[model samples]
Target: MNPPDVAAAVVVGGLFAAGCYLLLQRTLMRLLFGFLLLGHATNLLLLIAAGSPGAPPIIGAARIGDEPSADPLPQAMALTAIVITFALTIFLLSLVYRSRQLHGNDEVRDDAEDRRLAENQQREASAAAADPHRTNGSGQARTAADEGGNTL
Candidate 1:
């Protein structure tokens, strides 16, 4: 391969790496940007691999005995890729918008407090199910007073 082709490959590879890194981020915008970068990197790699341009790939009486024309397969493939990427970009953008609207935030984060609360609730529910109406000696539901008034 030529120097230009090698450079293109390197750049495309770098873009792909960056895209992959960005895609792992929690933010939806970063994910969308990563996807867009990945699409461009793929298109660039395809273009570089197709070789330099020459004559059009058209068969006519004027060139019946000429050398092989430029291959349009890569170009066609790139076009299809671009169209698909565009559609995906639109879909992803819409998804990001909907997520932002519903969550009121774009960055994804774990709701630790919510998870803890849910776990506690589940524990309490299971305890209640196991002992429906088992009251302590003081006729109260296991309070600090029953445990010698040691505030937690």
Candidate 2:
């Protein structure tokens, strides 16, 4: 097959870039739109990879000196991709719906556990700074005199 057209390549790249940007957003709606865009882009790429369209590969439909019979593999793959995209889109839609119902918004919120963990780490760091090398695991620094006056 001949080399791909520059315009088609640019369009596919643009679609993928835009879709990734949207998918990284905090809102479900934007993510859904991105998913759809990516799906379309994938379908277009597959069809383009199949090369210029030709008559279906039929035993009796062969024409001399005409376009080479089209390969059905890419077409079949593209069709399967379309179906899978549709199914995943539906799943994402349901997730968006459930998120809205539970949180009253489509925007994903930061996880509380993550914030708590950060706070704990900060507190531990401050404590470590305040008491460097205090080994007994107590607020009061360990001392030989304090250990029953051993004084060793």
Task: Show where candidate 2 strays beyond 4 Å.
Answer: 62-65, 118-152
| lDDT comparing candidate 2 with the true structure | 0.80
Model 2, residue 58: C-alpha shift (Å) = 4.1
Model 1 scores worst on lDDT over the 10 consecutive residues at 137-146
lDDT tens digits, residues 1-152, model 1? 43566678889999999999999999999999999999999998888778876577876635645555777899899999999999999998998999899999888766666655555556556667778776442234334233432422
TM-score of each: 0.64, 0.70
* Candidate 1 local Cα displacement, residue 5, angstroms: 1.1
**Residue 152's lDDT in candidate 2:** 23
Measured on C-alpha atoms, candidate 1 has an lDDT of 0.78
lDDT of each: 0.78, 0.80
Q: Give the TM-score of candidate 2.
A: 0.70
Q: Which of the numbered candidates is closest to the native, going by highest lDDT?
A: 2
